[model samples]
Target chain A: MLLKVKNLNAGYGFLNVLWDVSLNIGKGEFVALIGPNGAGKSTVMKSISGLLPPKSGTITFDGQVINNQDCAVNCRSGLSYISEELNLFTGMTILENLEMGAQMLEDKNKARENLDFVFELFPRLEERISQYAGTLSGGERKMLAIARGLMSNPTMVLVDEPSLGLAPQVTDEVFNALRLLNRQGLTILLVEQNVTKTLKFSSRAYILEKGKVVLEGPSSELITNDHVRKIYLGT
Target chain B: MNNSRSIKAVEWLKSSGGITVTCTILVALAVSIHKGPYVLVNTLVTGGMWALMAIGVSLLFGVMNISNFAHGEYFMIGSLTAYYIMHPLKEYLLETPNSFLAFITPVLGIAGATLAGVIAGILTDKLIFAQLRKRNREGWLLNCFLITIGLSIILINLHMLIFGNTFKGVVNYWDVPSLALGDVYVSVDRVVVFFIAMLAILFFWYLMMYTTLGKKIRAVAQDENGARMVGIPVNRVYSTTFALACGFAALAGGSLLFMFPSYPTVGIAPLYNSWFIIILVGFGNVAGAVPGGFMIALFQVVTRTYMGEGWENVIPMFLISAILIFKPYGIFETKVRSVWEQ
Candidate 1:
């Protein structure tokens, strides 16, 4: 297994958001967690990314318990998290944003190689590398955020709401990029609102309602699963 | 053809930073032709030292969101530290004066002053600011200013009690020979002070631009939570930035002792001067503060030379009001942001 979470209970301040949530991802698998707005999907991603402390649970990655580790340390340990905020340093240029991801690396050559790899993945980013990130289109910003994550050369990536507030055409580009990365053997745990599109790309899917996992199965089965159909696909 | 050319010139002047630079150059040229090159050098040296203090203000406000109103007191303390150190050293050197010992005494005294400033900064952070940091209240900048205003008062009085009400003579540090060049004669001490200020400013610029620590400071300044997410210890950066600001202020104070007298309220005039510089350059714009300081210094020196010595006190206030009324972000607003945008 690349990543595992057991009975995760987490929240902000006194408000508990996640309860008894268990999930696991095998190496190189693409998994999706789908739900409506305010379904605690983002919170689960936050907890796994170590941005939020779990009230009760164990988050193990690569056989080490990484519950409540610092976000950067977790990132350095190969768990790249791209938050819903698309948290690129907006004031910085695109190249600087990518360089910041690999800032902790000692070998400049390694960082340069990673930068080249990211540029290969998102050539649009390379084309406009000198422009400030704030000026990028919504789709390009998402691509840049994912490319920044790749700069760290993470083993697994947890992405939240990649398609939020994007045009249908642009959303396809972002997801297609993720699919390409996944096919190259990077494990992915994605939290998204577009259940049908996410299911099409994911190997396995978990349907979350409110704070609980209502259903879980392979994506092929979940697409036809009656509960997922009624609650999500609107069929 | 001339009308179109003049319109283009007007457009260029109306653009960001163009008017400010043009105005500064005009003033500098007017001063040079009127007051001679010696006074120009003198004004630059004075401005350089003031710029160092302004840079401290900019850094503290930029990274920590705290405007260190008691910054001048740190400078005053540095001067006082130098005064206390030099008094004993002067007396000992007078008895069996060695040229090397005489040279080393002021150097050591300045070091002591810098150390004292850093220590005071650490204490201020641990005792007063750190508690407020934990509370993390809104209007914390206002809270910091209020507390620092009170701190400024307490520090002024404490200095009076400790060092006495009388102005302590700072003769040993600055009593160096003057160098004559053509019609202009410049003091070696002023030249040394200017070089030191430039070096210090360059060091800070290098630190913020190239180093990991500089990146961390900028990250914290941009977004504290974001910095923390990147594994930077935000609180530690805050404390270090504060200390560095204080150290810069102390260094300025130590350098000023060579030219000025040290008193309990010695920092009062410079405090107000720093406020003007902060306003002139905009708070948190460290790169602009140096040029802002020189502009103000030139304005003061020129006005004092032609108009009267009294205009030195009145001109900065007038300029501040004019700037606030028109360009409230200061002349170097765009430039400051661009310098760190990498």
Candidate 2:
């Protein structure tokens, strides 16, 4: 397994979100965690990425125990998290935002190469390279945020609710980009509210309800399961 | 494409060109009034020093989102260090058979001041600011403000106790006889101070614009949580930024000491003056601090020279207040707030 969470429990002050949530992802695999709002999807992502301190349990990434590592250390270890809220440095230009993503890398040439790759992935970002991230359209900002995460060339990517505020067409565009990246051998853990779309893209799925995983299996199998279909798919 | 191109052009004009034009016009006016090269040089030099302090204060606010009330204490400490060093060194260097030591005294004074500034920065962080950071409370700023005010009072009193509250001028040894350029007399110290201040500002500019550390600092300033998520070490950046700003402020203090005399309470005027410059330059725009410093310094010099000392006090107060009312973001704009939001 590339990443494993054993009975992970976490939350904000006085409010517990995750309780004994155990999950795992294999190397280069695409996994999805889908649930309704307040299902602890974001809290899981935050705990794994070291944004919030986990109350209990272990998070092991690539053979190293990483339960208590800070965000910077986790990022350096090749785990990147893109939060639902627009976290792009709004004051910075698209190019500058990408540059910041590649801040930990020492080689300028490597950074330049990554920048080229990111621009190619999102042509709109290339066109708006000098434009402030704040001024970008909602769809474009989401693309920029994802593009920034890609710049770091992480071992695994944890993307939270990419479809949150995007239109259906834009959502398709973002998912397609993620699909292409996963196909190119990047491990991905996609957290989303769009059940149909997430299951369509991911190989494995975990159904989270109120901080605990109620069901977990191959995405194809779970999509057809009566419980998942009724509870999540509105079948 | 055409519509986007036009929008981009408009933004470029709105953001960069307007500020540049205003600064140029003001500089030209100052030059025109003082036809003598020395007078112009002196004004520019003094302006650069004031700008350094303003830039330091602005950067602290930008990154930490906290007002550092103890910033002026950094300046005072720097000048005091220089004063202490010069007091004992002047006798030894003057008595030395060689004149070289005398020539090098000012450099040593600056070095001493820089060291003192670094120490003061570390202490401020470790003793006071760090505690606030841990509390996860916003009240640290208010606490720091009150603490600094109290610290300043104690510092001045301590200065009175130890240094006897007497003004001490940094002794000059270059004796290069002032260069006579028509009506203005230019001294070597003024010329040296100008170049030093310019170099310091340029160095800071390069660091903020081009270096990795600079990028990290800017990231934290823009969004602390976002920066940390991206793996930037926020605490290390904060402490280093504080030290860097204090170092710049100290350099300014040292330059001021070279140009004038120092007393325990002498830092009060420059501290007040820098507060005006900080606002006039915009809260977080370091680039604006340079011109803002010069603008205020020129106002002081010109008013003092032409309209007498009485106008020196009146003009800065009026100009700063007027500018704040009209352009609260300052002469140079910063990203701390959106223009549309305002």
* Best-fitting candidate, scored by lDDT: 1
lDDT of 2 by residue, A143-223 (tens): 998988877779999999999889999999999999999999999999998999899999999989999999999999999
Residue B123 in candidate 1, Cα distance off native in Å: 5.1
| Model 2 TM-score (2 dp) | 0.88
Query: What digit string (tens of lDDT, one per residue) describes model 1 on residues B232-295?
Result: 5667777788788888888888887877667888888777788899888777887888888888
> Candidate 2 has which clashing residue pairs, if any?
none
- Deviation from native of the Cα of residue B192 in model 2, angstroms: 1.7
In candidate 1, stretches whose alpha carbon ends up further than 4 angstroms from where it belongs are: A1-22, A53-68, A167-169, B1-13, B36-38, B119-139, B172-175, B303-313, B333-342
Q: Is the docking of candidate 2 incorrect, acceptable, medium or high quality?
A: medium
User: Which residue pairs overlap in candidate 1's backbone?
Assistant: none
Clashes of each: 0, 0
Of candidate 1 chain B, the 10-residue stretch with the lowest lDDT total is: B333-342
